[model samples]
Target: MAKKVALLQGNEACAHGAVYAGCTFFGGYPITPSTEVAEVMSVELPKIGGAFIQMEDEIAAMASILGGALTGAKAMTATSGPGMSLKQELLGYACIAEIPCVIINVMRGGPSTGMPTGPSQSDVLQARWGTHGDHPAIALAPSSCQEIFSETVRAFNLAEKYRMPVQVVFDEIVGHMRERIEFPEPGELEIIDRTEPTVAPEDYKPYDTQFGDVAPLAAFGSEYRYHVTGLNKAEDGFPTTKAELVDAEQRRQIRKIEDARADIESNEEYQTEDAEVIVLAYGSTARSGRYAVDRLREEGVKAGLFRPITLWPFPEKRVQELAKQTKGIIVPEMNLGQMVLEVERVVARDCAVELIGRVDGEPITPTQIMDKVKEVL
Candidate 1:
């Protein structure tokens, strides 16, 4: 099978990626910058015998996807900042219920109604803490159209493997930007389905498994019936208020992701082998940071690039390793130093951490990053 190359916007690639990942359902609302994701899904899903729905609002959209997943369908929803904010409570519900679903949260400028068509990476922290409580957050950010496709598939895989929600985040820049994208042939992508209960219907436990941290799922309409709730649930999936029961359930929720820490973390290193300075970045910011590393190299400065493909679970171990080789770390972000603080925490003064940030909806260019590099030196 010859691979096809298409000039696609990031959102379009995301929709295509969902299909390749075996998604049979999409529930979303139309909002600027991210509405294209829904538009593409609406057209694509039906052709493949899947479903597409536009709900009353973001809340209903979020709810619909959860319903779809409970029916044993690969499901997803897409939205921007304000819409994403509306979906938080339900997002928390999906988390507590151990539902496997994908959320596509496109970045936009906002605290509330700030900018509809602007690009901002302010939502990175929100994606980490928006839902509330001490739950695991698995998020992946991609910089290009091709990556948007690949990462969306990876997001679905992670969600199913862990039986929890996973977020594929991109900013306004990548969401609307068009570029060439290459898709792998059919059967080439590594698609994984949720595990089904080996036990009979009478013994199904959605939250508990003797097999591993991730329990087998019993679809709602299947013979295997199980209870699910937003309240902290014990192994049986019913609401519980007992302190020890709640503690055990919460720890299992955290441990499922924490225990799979090796699989959930991803990053890329460029020219760091003999470099004394490293510039850490992600999403669209890394595009410029890539050029900054090259420019510094041409000027005889030993600068390298560190990009996080999976932003959450933070990739702390890798940064800690790099901290031993560098004297300074520079972080460039679209928000005002959100991830820079993360870098500082990991480096722990083993080196200097500098931040170059922008919030005016304008991109922080490569020259700006290079200038920051010089300033730090």
Candidate 2:
């Protein structure tokens, strides 16, 4: 198959990737830096026999997708800063209820709708802990339009495979920036659908172990019918009041990701094996950090980049090794010290962990990252 090349924004590319990944339902509200995702899906979904709904608000948008996923549809929603806040409740619900879904968060400056149109990565910690629970989170960070598309597909795949909510975390710059990209041919990308129970309906359990940590999921309208509650549930997926069942289910919810940490973790290490200073970043910041590291390398500075593609798991082991080997690590991000905290914890007493962060609705330039890299070196 011939691949097509187009100049596309990150949000537009993500919508197309969702469609290609077998997304059959989209429910979203128009929010800055992310509304394009909904607009593109609205125009394209109907053409492909999928449903695109414009909900009244971000909260409703989150609810709609969760409901649609119950019927066995591959469903998703997109949002930015304030909208992400609105969806946190349902996000928790979806997490504990063992529903499979995808969320695209095009981050912007925030506390309260700080910069609707500007670039800022002020949602790193939020994506990890926005929902008030000890539930599982699988979030991916993409740096460019092509990366956004690929990660969006991965978001759906991971969600379906694990039967949990997965997030594609990007910033306002990547969401709106137009770049030329060659899309993968349909046959080039791998698509994963959720597993179904092989047993009869009467013998099925939505949250029970089957093969791996992930349990088989049967769509609600399918021959297999089961009940699930936001409260801690037993293997049968019903609400549980017993301490033993609650403890077992909650531990399993967390262990599913922790045990599979090796498979879920991803990062790109550039010249970090023997560097005096390592610059750490993700999303659009990684783009700037890349140029900074290359220029620093040209100027006789032993600087490298260790970019985390999977943000939730935090890529701690490699970072720990780098901290032990290097003199310092520089973390440059759009928000003030969110992920830097994690770096500090992991690299405690091994090496210095420094951060250059801004939340003023402007992106940190390569020059700025280079300056930090030079200072650290």
Candidate 3:
């Protein structure tokens, strides 16, 4: 059979990818640079017997998905900068409640409605710390539309596997750009569903630790009846103020991701093995970084690119190694400076770190990156 291919925008591909991952519930509010995701879902979901709802507001959208997730639906929502800000509280709720859902954040410039259609990587830190609390966060930043699709599916897998929320974040450039994508056939990509409990209904605990760090989740309408709340909870899932239980629960939630960091972190390196200078970037900025690497190589500069697909749990070990090997690292971002701070912290003065940041609604281009590379060298 011939392959299935289509010219798709990043947001549209994300919706298709979510369906391929068995997403049966989509609760979202339309927002610039990300509304296509909801539009696509609305049209496609009904045909698959799935549900797509445009909530009255961003918070409601997030709440709807959390409710859907508890009913054993592979739920998801998409939004841009402003909407993400509104969803923070429920995002924190998902973290503490251990809800399995995916959030697609197509980033645009913002402290508050800074730019509606422009690309920005400013949310890099927000994805990790937006919600008020030291909760575990899994966020992926894909460079292209095709990657947006696959990463969206992977986002769902990680959420289900860990029984926590996972975020797929791409900037407005990648989110709105058009690209030809070949659809993955059925069974072509791995699809993971949350583990269902094997225990009897009466014995089921939503946060049971005996099963492991990530307990099996039971459907809300199923035979299982369990409590869930945003409050610090015990293994039984009811609110608990006991310091010991609260502390343990908090530690366990963090440990589940931290302990599995090796498995969770994903990055791509181009020509970095013998590099003297490494350009580290993610999202759409990495596209320019890659172009800069190639151009620098043509001119015989020992430059390379390091792109982190998994933005959070920031690929520290690999970066530390790169810092030791490279004389300097140049970071180009669409923001004033967010991820560069992370690189500096990890490098810890092992190598000189420089930032080329843009925040005037323009993307960091190859010429800018190459200029920084030459200066670094």
Minimum summed lDDT over a 10-residue window in model 2 is located at 205-214
**Better model by TM-score: candidate 1 vs candidate 3:** 3
State each candidate's clash count: 0, 0, 0
Q: What is the clash count of model 1? A: 0
Give the TM-score of each candidate.
Answer: 0.98, 0.98, 0.99
Write candidate 2's Cα lDDT for 1-377 as tens digits.
Answer: 56789999999999999998999999999999899999999999999999999999999999999999988999999999999999999999999988999999999888887888888888989999999979888999999899888889988998998889999999988999999878888778899999988888999988876556689888888789899688888888888899988887888889999887797888998989888999999999998988988998899999889999999978889899999999999999999889999999999989989999998878889999888777765
Best by TM-score: 3
Model 3: lDDT to the true structure: 0.93
Cα error, residue 256 of model 1, in Å, equals 0.9
- Alpha-carbon runs more than 4 Å astray in model 3: none
Instruction: Mark the regions of model 1 whose C-alpha exceeds 4 Å error after superposition.
Output: none
lDDT of 3 by residue, 78-114 (tens): 9989999999999999999999999999998888887
Worst window of 10 by summed lDDT in candidate 1:
204-213
The alpha-carbon deviation from the true structure for residue 172 of candidate 2, after best TM-score superposition, in angstroms, is 0.7
Give the Å shift of residue 24 in candidate 3.
0.7
lDDT of 1 by residue, 1-377 (tens): 56899999999999999999999999999988799999999999999999999999999999999999999999999999899999999999998898999999888988887788988888888878999888888999999999999999999999999999999999988999999988888888899899988898998888775867889898998898888789888888888999999998888889989888899898989998987889899999999999989999999999999999999979998899898888889988888889888888988978899998898989889999998888878
